[model samples]
Target chain A: MALFLVNVLDGFVTGLLLFMLCSGLTLIFSMMGVLNFAHASFYMLGAYFAYQISLVTGFWAGLLIAPLIVGVIGALIERYGLRRVHKYGHVPELIFTFGLALLIEETVQFFWGKSQLPFSEPAALDFAAFAIAGNAFPAYKVFMIAVAMGIFLTLLYILTKTRIGMTIQAALSYPETVQNLGHNVPLVFMCVFGVGTAMAGLAGVIAGPVLGVFPGMALQLGSIVFVTIVIGGLGSLWGALVASLIIGWLQTFATAYDITAEQVLTAIGFTKPELIWDHPLQDLWTLTLPQLGPILPYLLMIIVLVLRPQGLMGNRES
Target chain B: MNKFNLMMATALAAGLAAGAAVAQEKVRIAFIDPLSGPFATTGTQGLAIYRHSVKELVNEPGALLDGQAEFEMVPFDNKISAKESLIQLQVAMDQGIRIIAQGASSGVANALTEAVAKHNRRNPDDPVIFLNHSAVDPALTNDKCQFWHFRFDANADIKMDALTDDIAANPDIKKVYVIGQDYSFGKAVAAAAQRFLKEKRPDIEIVGNELHPIGKVKDFTPYARKIVGSGADAVITGNWGGDMVGLGKAVMGAGFDKPIYTYYGATSGITAAFGEEGDGIVKLVGAGQVNPAPTPEAQEFIEAFYVSFPDLDFGQPQMANVAPMLAAAINEVGNATDIKAIAYALEGMEYDSIVTGKTVMRESDHQAIQTVTVQGQTPEAAFEYDKSGRGMVAETVVELASNDAPTTCEMKRP
Candidate 1:
């Protein structure tokens, strides 16, 4: 039971981490109508930057400084790259970002090589938190959860309460109308893009140690963030939250169980024929969600898309 | 016209004709694999090895090039998808490629096999031969075996059959729990291990078996808990890459305190991930601690690999083991640059390798029969070892079946 609780906490922590990436993605998609495929690339950049910065000025400085650098880089891309490609339409913008994503991944490979970086947990939190049912939950996990949760709450407050947040939200509804109302709509878009990318950078800062800042990590997790937003609802922040949490829990819970597809088939009276019993797929049926957790978001997104195109709490149609 | 002017014009025309023929007759061999995307790292390594083997084959002093002796290697990206591989195969054939090499995963390999077979049935004379080097699925040799396809890598059954004898000898290990990646290679290794273990020691029990997805697994605490609580004396796993590292970290961090037996665990990358914690993890593969040192040819390849990649630690790289095997296979193909001759040459061929004394590819299943090495981490720091992490204080080479197990393949020899 204690193990179960630890897993739940782990799931929640992972979910918030997903939220940090997804929140930025959905907001960017909502405002610009183009899914920034390179958002995860920026996250990867943040992790690498943090690693570099941490080597010089410890984890705390990296935690504070890396995301700002990522935010600035993101704003530059929005202003120059995405803005230039925007003239050709949203599809071209999406394509441009996709190209950007691939470039970023290649650049990362060129910089770091094809090996996992030795990103260690902070020295301060380098111990087990609790031993439950003879398993020690590491303190680093709890710290990650706390920081991710803090970031989420802080971002939520800033989005809902601040003047800048109100303007950005209005710009999302009516970009030209807001411009007519004497507000710089382009600047708002740029800022929102910057903030969204910054959130992903924040996720990288925390997730780097655990995820092991690697070259392919951005490509691995980039599509999942899209899945999270799509499953949550295209432009709904609350939907992203639900989807991310659900995905996190689903992955944690799925891997925890030991069940096989053959069992289900056998229960349904499909006994294995000795001739075909030795087939490779006989073992494939044993796979669970945790086994496929990385792709589960896409599966969920597909299911959600088929059933509810608007998403769980989404008002806008995909 | 004058006799002198006519002779000069004829010679110039003949020279121009020969040059055109040389350019047109160049055989294009398509190299399809996941060249981009997440799994491209492995694909890239495979490509590098392929290039090195080809360079060795072509640049060999007495190597023959047959009638035309010219070729172009055109590589296409399959993105690790079976369907995509099939499409790539079709496109490659459409682009006038009569042969291809690659299959980073079994799914792609199997799909390409079917696609190539379908192409053969439709066009008998213009056949495409696929040389698969990386996909280690046993079923590819068994149920899904194709006449046009030939595998170079040691199959899952060969690897498991090798490890079973050593495991059977260890009476201390009575209970075994299997944990593997949720994929064809992983499942095949686990199932093969289970079958062989049951065959040798009927009394030994498989306590619990679990399959986790590849690349998706992060925190393996729950999986580790299950394995630890199962009271298994030893655990066998077939996980690799980030999943392998993550699982090891989880097992160590959660204090799963059991010796982990693995097919690919004692990997160089695993050492990087777990550091000294990776000590005592046992891995089963063809090449480990290439003792008796290596042949002059093998030493040349090893030295070249190191010189090319100085940043990478030359310790337990799986590529170092697999690359030499691949090179030997290419060598045996013998002046056969096209797929058909290469396939025929590879089947039922034996070669003296640095690691394995006499590795043979069985005629019946086209599966490579070779020795397997059991590697354990050395406690003594700065221990001497071979490239595959064997020859240390604690390492053993175990022999398994000398041929591929009875397969249901009806591949008629051409």
Candidate 2:
């Protein structure tokens, strides 16, 4: 039971972190109808920016300032780069973002070099928040959970209870109508893209200390971010959240267990092979849940895609 | 004016001839490893180490075979892929680079070994020799061993032999959790750990064994939790690069205060990431000790290496021996162009390693047999790694007089 509780807490932390990256990506997709391939790159930039800032102003100041810098950069990219590419259609927009992602990764490597930076959590939050059955959960993870929940709530409030939020939503559905009503639709798109990237940057800031701050970090989480939104349903915020949580739990539980194919096969009335090591299916026979942990998310994504093409909460068919 | 013009043309021709002769005296080594990808950090560090080692030990004046030949390292980015490595191998061969040096991934190493062997078989006159510095898959020197391949680093089996000896001596370690990346090298480490531990400490139980995908895991909290929950006295893993750092951080973060034994828990940002948390709990099993500075010469080499590449740790101490050993073989053979003669000279060669003392290249398998040390992270380490005050200090040293395991290699000597 204690182990289960710890797994739940760990999974929750992982899920919330994923949601932080997915929320922004889902928002940008909804508004622009273009999946921002560089969304994770923005997250990486956030971490690198914060690491650099933290060197001078400390982690707290970096936490506040880094996301803003990333937001402005994202806004500019959307205005100067994506806006120009938007006319050539979705494929071009995607290619542009893909190129941007590559460029961002290279730029990061050029500056930071190719090594894991010693971006540790603050000393204040270094202690264990709580211990369950000898397993101590650090205060930093709790902080991450808090920050993610705070962003989700704030984003929910602004989108549902505010005028700008309504305008942005209206622009997404009917840009011509919104533009005719005297609102700058392009400006709205730019803001959404900026805000979305900023959120990803925020995730980077928090996740950097835990997940590590390195050049490959963006690539590490890049595909997973896409998978989360896709599993949750494209352009659906709620879907992203749901999918993120599901993946989090799925991976965590899978890793926590030690169930092997041998055990399953034995239970299913299959006898063990005489020369197991020499057997062709030895790899399959020895396969364990923990070994399969990393691929569990992709497996779930495939299952979701096969069963529900539109995603759990997404409106779009894609 | 006619006499001056004639003199100028003669001088230019003489200079061109001298340049060609100098170029002929240069020995080129193609360094094939990941230079652009997730594993680039490790590969880049490796390249830096090789470049620095060659500059200090082979290329510098009064260095090994200093006047005989100038050694140059030509880097080729393999992107850590086997196909790309083979392609790089072909490019290097085309460029007249007879010496191929690589070590990052065992899979790539296997491919290069096969390709080089095939190339040597087909083109015996222009045979290439592979100098492996760090890839530790035992199969590379065992069933898959090639005459052209010489491994400078201790293979997985030997390292595990040294590691299990340390574990056997520790009475407190009754149970161990063995984990590694899901690959050939990782599997070898796990299997070796299991085999060696069972042989050394019969009473000790392997509580858990698992393999996570290499470079794919971002968060290891769940894995750490499982390890802690397993009630293991110690943890053993063969993970390297970011995986090493991540696993170290996660295990330590999860409050598993027990020691986590690893094949590569130091250097390349791992030591820095572990920082104060790893203090005494993170133990690494490998050749070459940096903390206490194994020898005075090694200490000097370490200082010089830092001067050249201040950002990189002298991670691969075996790299210090590679160029010098190769130079010794070349000098014994009397020329760099005679690949076969150099290969024969390198076999059963004895070289005094500055870090690990006297080391031998086994005649049968070409695996380096040297002093393997199991070091622990300590703040008192003389040479701090990755700018982290804490560094690896030698806790246990195993001086092997011969290969730990009998060779399965059947060398086809030409």
Candidate 3:
């Protein structure tokens, strides 16, 4: 039971990290009508920026300043780069961000080399907060959960309660109508992009220490961020949250357990076949839980897609 | 005033041209390796070693070749791809470069080896010799050996032979967990470790063996937890790069206090990545040590290299011999451009490496037989300075490798 509880908390922490990235991405997709494929690259920039800042001023200063710097850079790119690409059509806009992602990865490699940096967790949070069943849960993990929760709540309050939130919702469906009502639609888009990227940057700064600050971090987390947004359904922040949590829990739990295909076959009343290597489904028989851990999220995504065309919290269209 | 400056520049250019005209002609070795991309630092480090060797051994008047040969090292970026390496090979051939020095990825090395062997068979008159400095996959020396591909470093099995010998002697490591990247090299390491440990210490139990996809997993926390939970006394891995960093951090973070044995660690930013977490806990098996150099020349080379390239360290000190040996081979053949003769000459060659004393190139498999060291990171106070400002110290140094491993190379020599 203690192990289960620990796993639950771990899954929650991982889920919240994913949510921190997806919430901004879902918002950007809703407002701009073009998928920002470079979203995870923004996450990468956040980590690198924080790492550099931490080197000079320590982790606290990095926490306070890195995302703001990322926000400004993101705003500039949206204003100058993406704004020009927007007029060409969504295809071109998608292509632009895709190209931007590649450019950012190369630029990062050019500067940082292809190695993980020594951007470790602060010394204060280095010890275990608690131990369950003889296994200690790290204090840094508690800190991660706290930050993720804070970001989730702040995002919830802003998107649901604020006047800008209402404006953003209105702009999502009727950009022309919002512009007709005397609001600067282009300014709104730029603000959304900047804020979304800043959110991603915040995720990067905090998670960088835990996830490791490396050139490959972006590539590792890039597709998963998109998967979160997709499986949660586009334009639905609530859906993104749900999908992130589900995928996170699924992955963590899958890794926590040690189930093998042989167990399933035996449970189904099938006799174990000797010389499994000679069997037709040898790979299937040899597969185990830890090996399947990374794939569990995608398996969940497949199930979700087949069951509901719209995600759990996604909108039902005509 | 402008005309005078222009005339002075022209005169300087002419003087250099006249000096070059009187100088000896060169034997070019096309370095078809990564000059840019993720592996650029490694490639550039190798290129530096080659350049240093040329300056000290080949270019100097009283050189190893005795000024009979002036070898030029040309750079070509393979981008660390097999296909790209073949493309660069063609480009090198087009430019009339007959010797290729490449090492970084075993994948790229294999591609270059096969391509060169085919080139030798198809176009014997224009054969290109390959000198591999690193890439330690055993199959390259075993089943997949080629006449043209000669490796300067010992193979994976040889390194494992020394490592398992040391590990078996350590009574503390009764339980070992094996984890590596899910690729050919990683699998080979895992298999080799299991085979070697079973042979050396039959009582040592392999508690767990896991293979994660190369560069795919973000966090290795789950893997670390499993290692910790398994009650394993030690861990062995063949992971490198970001994967190594992530795994090492997670393992150390989880408070798994035992030593983690690795094939590629203690250098290439890993020491930096480990920081204080790896003072003595993370151990590695490799060719040489950076500090406490065995010879004065090597010590001078290390000092000068660090002074010039402060950001990089000589990861594989065996690479120091890459150019020297190539020069010796050219001298042996009495002709620098005689590719086949040079290839044959490289066979069974012996040299006293500054790092490892006596190193031999095995004639049968083209695998260099040399002393290997197992070392761990030490504080900066222990050594003056390393690339990470903290150098490594050797735990075990095998004077001569016990390389009794058999090979399947049935070479049809031309």
Candidate 4:
């Protein structure tokens, strides 16, 4: 029972962190329909910037400053980089961002070298938050959960209850109409891109210390973030949230459980093969739940894509 | 008669000129490894070590055969892939490079070894040699071993042979968990730990064993929790890169106060992130870097390496073994072009390194049999440049003979 509860908590923590990254990506996709491929690169910048900031001003100062820096950079890229390429159509825009992502990774490697940096959690949050059945929950992980939740609520508040939020939503749905109504649609798009990237940056700032900050950090988290937002829906924020949570639960629970194919096969009235090595399906038989845990999110993503097609909370009829 | 005599004299003159050119020609060894991507850091450091060794050891007077041969490195970036390594090998050989050097991934090493052997079999006259530096998968020196592939570092099973002794002696460890990256090297480590631990300490119970996907795991908190719940007294892992870093953080974050013995826990920017949390908790088993500088020459090499490349962490001067031995072999045969003599000279060569004292090149399998240094990370100032001041102190140093760990190698030498 205790193990179950901790798994739930752990899953939620991971889920919320994924939401923080996917929310920005989904929002950007909704507004500009650009599907910013370099969105995860911005998150990577946040972690590297935070790591650099933490060296001088400590973790708190890094938390505040790094995301802001990323936001400004995101806005600049949208204005100068993405907007210039926008006239060439969506495919070119995607190719441009993909190229930009590669450029960012190389740039990071050039500056930081290819080794994992010594980015560590702050001394303050470096303790056990609590334990369930002798298994200690890290204070830093709890802190990550709290910060993710805080971002979620703050983002929710700004997007749902405010006049600016309504304008942004209108722009996402009917950009031409919004522009015809004297609203700055392009500016709104840039802001959404900036803000979305900032959220990714913020995730990086917090998650970098724990996730292991290196050039590959972006590559590691990049695909999964896409999967999260996709399984949620391209333009649906709520869909993204649901999808992230699902992936988080799937990954954590899958990793937590230990069951082998051999065990399952034996239980199903099948006798064990004496020459396991000689079996044609030896690799399949050798697989356990832990071995398959990392792939669960992708499996879930595939299932969601096939079944729902539009994603869990996605509103498009197509 | 005059015309025939002139033709014979001209042909003899041409042959003499070619022999002289062969004797004076520079020897080029291609440094093929991951010079790009995530594993580039290790490759870069390795390149630095190779450059330094060639300058300070191999090219220096009395190092090479009458200092006549010029040792040069032909750089090729394999990008950490087996296929890319083979491509690089072909490119290098096409450029007249007769020696191929690479050591990052065992998968790549295996491919290179097989490719070199096949090339040797097909060509025979223009065969290249492979000098392995750091990839330590046991099978490379076992069943998959080739006559052309010579590893300078100790293999996985040899290191495990040294490690399990300490684990057996420590009565505090009642139950141990084996966790590693989901790959050949990791599986080998797990299997080794199980076999060696059982053989050494029959009373000790193995609590858990697992293999996580290599470089895919972002967080290891859940895995750490499972380990804690399993009531494990100690942990053994063969994880490297970000996976290793994340695992270390999770272990410390949950405050799992037990030692984590590892094949690669000593590296990958781990100690820097781990501050006080890592001190004495993490252990490593490898060839060199024991505390209190094994010899004056070893200390000098360490100091000189830092002076040359200040940014890099302290690494094994494993290349010292590679360059000096190759030079010695070439010198023994008095000709760099005599491939047979050079390979034969290296078969049972006994080398004395500044770090490990003496490392033997086994005749049966080409794997180096050296003293394994078991070290642990310490916060105190115990050793020189210990992972940017977070020192990896020596715990135990054990040397084994060439026949200590038997190989499955059926070497078919040329």
The candidate that achieves the highest DockQ relative to the unseen native structure: 2
lDDT of 1 by residue, B113-208 (tens): 888878877876677877676577878878888777777666777667666666788888889888888767777877888898989998889997
Count of backbone clashes, every candidate in sequence = 1, 0, 0, 1
Which residue pairs in model 2 clash with each other?
A: none
CAPRI quality of model 3? medium
lDDT of 4 by residue, A171-282 (tens): 8788899999999988998899899999999999988888878898888888999888879988887888888999998898889899899899888988877898999888
Number of clashes in model 2?
0
| DockQ for candidate 1 | 0.30
Q: What's the TM-score of candidate 3 when only chain A is evaluated?
A: 0.96
For each candidate, what's the DockQ?
A: 0.30, 0.74, 0.51, 0.72
What DockQ does predicted model 2 obtain? 0.74
Worst 10 residues of 2 chain A by lDDT: A309-318
Instruction: Write model 3 residue lDDT over B218-307, tens digit each, in one string.
Output: 777767777887889889999987788889887887778788888777666678778777887887787765556767877877776666
* lDDT assessment of candidate 3: 0.82
Could you give the TM-score of chain B for each candidate, in order? Answer: 0.80, 0.95, 0.93, 0.91
Q: How does chain B of model 1 score on TM-score?
A: 0.80
Candidate number that wins on TM-score, 2 or 4: 2
lDDT, candidate 2, at B43: 84
List candidate 2 stretches off by more than 4 Å.
A278-281, A316-318, B1-24, B61-66, B401-404
Each candidate's interface RMSD (Å, one decimal) is 2.9, 1.3, 1.8, 1.3
Worst 10 residues of 1 chain A by lDDT: A282-291
- What TM-score does prediction 3 earn? 0.93
lDDT of 3 at B364: 85
Best by TM-score: 2
